[model samples]
Target chain A: MSTLSEPPKQSFHMGMLLNDTRYRGYTFQFIALLALVALFGWMVSNAVANLAALGQDINFGFLSDQAGYDINQQIIPYESTDTHMRAAFVGVLNTLLVAVLGCILATIVGVVVGVLRLSNNWLIARLMSVYVEIFRNVPVLIWILIVFNVMANALPSPSTFRGDDATASMLLGAFAFTNSGVYLPLPLWLEGSIVVVGVFVVSLIAIWALRRYARHLLYSEGRVIPTLPIGLALFVVPTLLAFFIMGRPIALEYPEMGRFNFQNGIQVRGSFIALWLALSLYTGAFIAENVRGAIQAVSKGQTEAAASLGLRPGRIMSLVVLPQALRVMIPPNISQYLNLTKNSSLAAAVGYMDITGTLGGVTLNQTGRSFEAILLLMAFYLAISLAISGIMNLYNNSVKLKER
Target chain B: MKNSLLLGAIAVTGMVAGAATADTLQEVKDRGVLNCGISTGLVGFASQNANGDWQGFDVAICQAVAAAIFGDANAVEYNPVTNQVRFEILNSGEIDMLSRNTTWTFSRDVDLKLDFLGVNYYDGQGFLIPTELGVSSAKELDGAKVCIQKGTTTELNVADFFRVNNIEYEPVPISTASEAQQAYLAGTCQVYTTDASGLAATRASFEDPSAHVILPEIISKEPLGPLVRHGDDDWGDVVRWSLNALIAAEELGITSANVDDLAAAPTDNPEINRLLGTEGTLGEMLGLPADWGVNVIKANGNYGEIFEKFIGENTPIGLARGLNAQWTDGGLLYAPPFR
Candidate 1:
């Protein structure tokens, strides 16, 4: 048995700050705080003195100055006469575009490969295992370089696409992949295309409502309503009807064969293609392992219980195993997405003018503002990473189980 | 406690500030090596040879400076920096002088606070294209994809050229010259544009050098040279005169072969006497020994000799000394008189 009582009372003294046990933790913490402040102060002071000696000052006035450089690809209107800020904005958009595209592609490839790796088929499982080993074991940078080289050497020249006796022909007579880039047909929005798109959105919401109604019927009246076929009808019937009523308001603009390239079409540059494919394949390998681990982490007893309850194998996976496996999979998957986004900075190696290629690179070299440019680059990447993690965390919270 | 911490911090920072403001010349002397900035590798301009020794046009300049200071041509420590980090390395005092192939521009001089001593190589932007392209003039390069070295004036120059000509072209900005060369050869781009000297160097390294032709268009002036920090006039003067000594040696017919003989006895040319440090105390004024000019010429023969040895028509690079020849030979290279 233990009892709490004041056995002795001692008077406090000046030496107690160092000797007394009760005040010891606070004293050490106070000293540590002071040391941290001093270190920071010393570093800042040294930086200030060094800058002064170099006749340099931290200036942001150059952001508004004319960039006087042309960018090959831009999503918005940009000219050489635009300001540095405008050029940087274009770079930021390009970076985001590739990162988003890479993440989506990586996720799809990862989930497919992850699930297939557990297949009972020996041939298929071995093939997937080989792919994962080769991609995951090699450095991502080397993979990027290798992919870029292969694309550069393997693709036919644009000139080969020209003339009646052309050496290379476009696949499906629409997509042209050349040494420079890939060209594809773009969608031409006719007058009533907006109405057609609106109808499609309405149909999607109607399908969701139909599924909810089916679930309510099953719960309240013990009457099982077949939702899949009705939901499919809701998904297609309105959209098809709207398309005809609106005079089929979407048209395709095919890429026309030109002397050097396929003009009048959308061009996806080879650098972007290489960077996207390399990042997806490399990151997908790691993500595949995460997915496999998560799936296995779901206990086998869950599947057995579902089987005993007369659930089919597919339904058991969808309704019982998957939901639980996803919770385990998503947290690690968020980190993979973050990794892919950060690795997109390597787009510079292939000349894809991402944020690092333009602002942190050429702009810094041109303006001699390394300190400011690097600081801004760090800040932008930090913000992007934190934003990705924050959004993923929120989604994770919604899917997480309630605990006692 | 906070007051004592503040006092200690101030003391430490004061020592750092003192070290940063130390005279670069004295520091170099104390360190016993002149830190020189150069490119990672650019054939005939700044690159290491097969013998694992640095030998190039820009390397000669650094050697000349080192010889002028210590009477030893090998007294330099070369720091090979990438284009993205060269200026920062120079600005941070990590290198004593930047002898890299850096172009002198208005902004680099006035805004970046760098003092360019003199232009050692007069290069202008030009284009290189494969023979199959049949593009003789830059005007024919309309709608062509061009490979350009990034972080340099070539990108902006090419952009301005295309825009002003009212022609459309795509720029594939590459990080290094080797990458640009690879991409151009791999058919990723139709044209490669850089300084004319750079084009020559790159073409010489190509597997089929004869299959490529440089377009006859010098679009922009790129006066490449060595530079130092703006406020350091004493060091700047030493570097300027060392380069001037080479130019002067070429003009006076005093090559490395004849430098010692020319300095042994007073000649009819008093300017030669003053330059050879026999008739005046010019080296003393620069805080160097009496034979500084002799050492500089001995390090690298002379401007013409250096040019011929590295990138002249006889060399693999085969760059013609067109505008780089001396003023007396109807070229732009004119040095200030030594008197």
Candidate 2:
């Protein structure tokens, strides 16, 4: 004790770890981290011991084995003779396909419905409300089942289109809708098809350039250009001209009745349609609510200020409020997209060979590698979710309030 | 304090190790109920009746096992498992054994570490299609969508047969038999393939059974039976012999009606005497009551009786025993001696 003037020279003591304010936080944090690490270690060791006792070891060698199964929709050419790794890749592609399609459709439908929900028309607003409430409140699994069952039962079998007195017929003698799937005429890429495709791509770029140029002209010299009609003409005329110049090289291969069913065309399997439509409709409702809330969150002052600026109602919404509301809408929108992506696992109910259906399903069952399969499945989803959040967060940072 | 923390971890490890080595039989006895996995629905094999009580060829095995373990046939928690989850359920110990129509395979038995008790039903894969398809042979099914139940040997067999025959068929894999039936009936698929027995059962459940025909293509040998997890040889023996007792009971002419009387005293037949636990201490060797076989027989009768009651030629399923008959009757069922 040195007269208590310098706190006894602040001597280090074991008790100080808990009693002293300066070290307490670090001490507690170290203890918590130790407990967490120990817990994880215990869990992992317990699992390993139990698995060994059951005469199983964690092995992912099954991925190299033959899949020996068929997938309904394959973006890549996959035979039953392909390896399980290839099968999983096909599953990943299918999962991505539905997620991408669902996100696009849901965004479009959600924005429209969300806008309509705030409309002055009582009937339209109420109808939009009814749509959101009915769809969002119900579980997505039931929707998937409903869509799959309706498609399977309500649609006629291809056999019905066989006889002279056919009960069902193809649509416009081109698209065939049956219980199995919808078939559309596939475009045959001929020698000059590339030229036609190139011309279309060029016309699309031209339209985009024209819009930018019109914006520039409007800003630099207050000249109004009817870019919509010009852009439309640019979209169609050049492509049509190139097609005729290339002698209409793209021919259509119509699906005709083969020995068993309609063959030789693009058969959009019913499983894909059921899963895609169900996910889109279900996730669209939640997105609609998000959009409506986000749009409303934009201060009434902003809308009034735009109106006072002599801008039209549509112009005020598009130019002033929506861009600002988007800042509020993005985080929840990311969550909805993630939900749609993950909910696509319900594809198994309808036998759509998404990642869950293949890797977590047939492959897991066949290989009897539940632990390894589930571990991989979780890792894949984690990676995907992190990537989605990372990208969306970057976009969020870009669109949010910035320092001047 | 550190000692206490270390002790807690040790205790948890001990608990996990203890669970791994836990005797399935003793667990079932302590719980007073046997968890038995069966198919979601295969009419004559494992489907439920109108009264919500399970009555089928497969359900009888569950009941018999429960009877052997608890002496009450009703002491069974029936777990309806899909093809995708049957092996997993068995391995997870959620069920003592899977009585579902699972085919015994090399990878499943060796790699997956399952113990197939014995072949309960000898079957072969076949296709069932509508009678109006105007096609008779399975070989003629080209470019057709085939509705198949996924996660079974049947899944692989279909792919194999199609490849070998140089045919192109689209596989529409569904999960449960009920779903497959719905898809097949709704015209989503031109062909539905599974065990011939399963096909008969599915057809019989149909409102118009006459509208379907089983194609004459027996693609693969499907030796479906009850199975347990590997390891725990003692419990494995109990389940294995439980199945064998039913099979042997049929061969020894032990009907459920006469089982009790025959079990009361030693019979002239030594095999029957040993089986009924009147002569030997085999039941004690299996860690059970000496009269377990008698309980099993009284629960579901013999194998033939169960077959007749559920899926025999007399039933709506109308399946003849075929290769499932006793060895004396020139079929494949040959149970090991009770001794």
Candidate 3:
């Protein structure tokens, strides 16, 4: 028979909040929180006091003021008389455009170079290693400056295409190459073009569905299908059929030589080209290293087992190696995307009218609203980085390894 | 305890930030150096020499101000500011004065709370183009791409110029004059726009200076001057009269060579005697020594000497004194009376 003995019950008292072990930890935490809140309150008040003393109050009315400036490349409508808010929005679009373009180009280059760097061919592997070392070791700013200089200096001027005895001529009689920029024919969308675009979209989805089915058949029924050839057929046939069926609703407006520049065409400015390519090449090098590490992280036995099962080398890689490597590779790759978006602030150096160049630049200087403009810029970059992280995490979830 | 310490630091930092808003003159005196802001490099305006000493047209103004305050021309700390951060740097008290080619405008003076001392260079915007481009008039420059320095009035003037002419032109905003020069030479931009004097300075540095021509268009009046933040009128008067002394010395035929002779004692010319601190108590009004004008003139000679030494026609800049001459010579450079 066990005799139960009750320990001495301590009475609840006000002193127990600090002396008792259970409450002491919480008491310290509460004190810390109180101190933190007080600190934050003090900082805000201090800033308000300092600004007031300078005869300046925090105001964002300047956003409605005229920008009084012009942008080199604008994706939306803008004028010197436009409000700063609209100008900032145009800057936002340009920044997004470069970031999106840079991400796509970096992924393509990083994946190709990463796979090639692991090749048994010594020359190819060594060359990729050299490229990664050179591009990543130096700062991104230097690469941007170098690429901008090369684009401007190496390209011929428009005057070279002028006279009968011209030293240079337009390529393909439609594309004009000049240091000012490359002049490409503008695409004109007429009536019924929307139907053609819809058809093209439908065909792309169909191709994706067919590929999924092909994979299903291979796994479940031991069947093989030539998905590439059939997917090409599915992609091309309907798009062409819809285009002709829509009565040729698209046309090209070729650039015509004006007195000073090529008028009536879209100019892909050198500044954009320089910033996009430089950011891609620099960030692609780090992504290459990540891919290389991720590939090696998957044990060698997996590859050997696939080889013994009579799988072809290319099929073994596509089916077994890269899919597993992607999970390990994605987290670090997400950070690279963040780095690229932030580094694009350096777009001002190359004269690319990205958000930093316009809003954080001329608008800040002209309106003398450096504080408000910078706060908005910081908010934008922070929002973009979080959004990128969230999108990448969702992608990571899809390839996550399953465990019981 | 750690968080409390951090909060204490935050409090101290706030007080310090607010404390720097005024009494800039005392701060400079305690530091024993005059902080002067200038452009990164504009060869004839502000740049470092072979001896690693800062020397140029704008540099001269800095030296004069420093000499007026410290009685030593070399008691200066040069802060090179870009087009984007000049005003912020000045307002933050990192630089006591900005001697860069900053224009005096209504907004910059009253709205931005800056006190412009006086105009040192009277400039106007103009266009520089390749000679063989066959473009004579700026109105003919329709559809041309322009490379211009942002944060200056040049871009606004060019935009207004083309808008008034009913022509469409693109502006490639560049950071510095050197990069703009590279873009212009590479033909990436069909035109480069800035002050006419700056265009001349840039052309003189070109490989083939004759291959380019400056378009005759004075788009906007840019009265470039030195400036200080408001609430320091004592320091402002010190800087203002230093500039006046330079201009008056030029009008009174007192060069750097004769400054010592003129300041030895009272001269026959009463204005010269007063300006050189050899008569009356003019320097006392500005809280400087009786020999304040001597220090200023000895720092960089008179305004005409400085202009001729750096950017006059005799120099490679080849800028003729069209509107920068003294009023006696039918120009607009007239200083206020000293007495």
Candidate 4:
């Protein structure tokens, strides 16, 4: 045993040497890591040197200074006397407003066009194909410009539509398009409308509970109840009763012609309308292609199996195809939403007071703080994109198939 | 590879040697060309015609600078620049001088480190609205949406003016003058704001020029002038005194027609002699030939002649030489002593 151990000492030394050799293989990776750190450090130092040379120290103190600029459309209260940070918040809110509204409208348009493009009717399919092809191929900026030009040239001047004349009334009632913007009636709430709204919320909960009960009855008792009708009744009955009890606290406020322009009701500027419409149309075209690809990605075998199980065509699509298609659809759809949010920045070109227009344009010019303005603008966009991705990832996870 | 390396070394040495000996003024003289930056089609300032030749008040300045440098009026290259990119281009040395209607402000001079030669045009920010709005004065534009071109001093002036007046305004900011004009015409904004001279230029482009009214309020001081990069003091002096020579020529009754005659025979006025390079070493001070001012006057008419030709009362812009007149006429345009 002593002789055998004495012979193995050299082998033990060889094993340690082999281990050291393996460790040396990672030296290249270590060097790469050090190189990356050095590159970043060099860049940071260069930025500091450049900033110092310009006598422009990077600080956020300017954000609290008076913005001294006015925003055309702000969701929150803003004034020229407000701080730049508050102005940035207003710009953020305006960006979110356009992004949210654009997403919802784009989704609706996308779904409709996507399904119509696969329709049995040839003419409708061809028309939707044209829409998708045209919008998807052209740059979004051109679409924005074209739409703005059309709105500017085609809409009647405000001076021509400021009276109760027959032509003016007819045109205003039909389209309500004016140079000031497109005016439409909004529902105005009176006193005690909160009670009615509370009733409506309670009814919605009841309707959801009724739907659950109906599903349970269908499974347990094998009795088919018209859940849609019962749900509708549960929703409308209490809301109507509360409306009468609260004395009908809602009224439609139609736009009325006033001196120089329209008064009352909602007035959306032509720039916003043109920009919103162009962004929705352009993004919806891309989303429609994604929807189509996702739908086609679902195996035909699933639909056939559902049909073999005696399900109708519509049920096969709803129960079998859509569940699987949605899994493939959500990731790409999130990216489209992000695209729509970023493209809304192009509204600046058309004079729409989105974040890029107000903060990046006028605020930067007024303050001469390009660094702060552009940094805030990029951060806002990044945060919005991350939020959308987070929500969509959760939705994708819920609809994803569990694989062995 | 060794032979190629030796050849590359020789080429780089030759290039450096050439660069070391190159004189900027002599290079310009030899090349017989001067690169100048001007506005992108402002009507009475600098604009291109259908024939693609630049003409107007600002263009004449470029021509005069070229003529001062190279004894020929046609030795100029004009590059159009917008407000957003003009300063960066000048700083990067892409153009020799910026003759666009740029407002000479404190920040541009000190912070940006540019040398504003002198105020060629005294202007101010003014508001313009459709006459149908019945707004005769800027004070009445309360709760109005003002269309302003972004990335310029005019935008800040608009905000400050509105705030000081206790008026609420929706600023519909745009990137270009054309966009502001379209927005104002389409009623997206109730009023359009810019320099008073710019308002006149924009209004003249309309089908009916009388349909818009320029508000009486001149809210901000805009001393529009030419500028060059900061460190080139010799170049700065050259541009400054060249402009002053034009003003001094007009004051001395030295028209372009009589400049050759006056140069051949010395004038009675010492200021004219110094400006025309007949007296003093002003030309030698700037490292130019003695007839530099004469060449400038020959290239373009004097300041008054150029202003009268482009934006005078008879022109479509119809701007009066109210504050742009000489000191003898009680205006602010007084040059420093030529000596």
**Candidate 3: Cα lDDT at A189:** 94
Q: Kindly report the docking quality category of candidate 3.
A: medium
Name the top lDDT candidate: 2
RMSD of each: 3.6, 3.0, 2.7, 4.4
Q: iRMSD per model?
A: 1.9, 1.2, 1.6, 4.9
Higher-lDDT candidate of 2 and 4:
2
Off by over 4 Å in 4: A1-21, A164-167, A170-175, A186-188, A221-223, A234-237, A252-254, B1-33
Q: Model 3 Cα displacement at A184 (Å)?
A: 2.4
The sequence of per-residue lDDT tens digits that candidate 2 reaches over residues A150-247 is: 98888888999887888899999999999888999999999999999999999999999999999899899978799999999999999999999999
Lowest summed lDDT across 10 adjacent residues in model 3 chain A is found at A1-10
Better of 1 and 2 by lDDT: 2
lDDT of 1 by residue, B10-79 (tens): 7876876775566877778788889999888789988887888998999999999999999999999999
The docking quality of candidate 4, as DockQ, is: 0.44
Enumerate the candidates' DockQ scores in order.
Answer: 0.52, 0.73, 0.66, 0.44
Model 2 misplacement above 4 A = A1-20, B1-9
Candidate 3 TM-score to native: 0.94
For residues B73-153, write the lDDT of model 3, one tens digit per residue: 999999999887898888888899999999999989987778999999999999999999888899988888898998888
For model 1, state the Cα shift of residue A348 in Å.
2.2
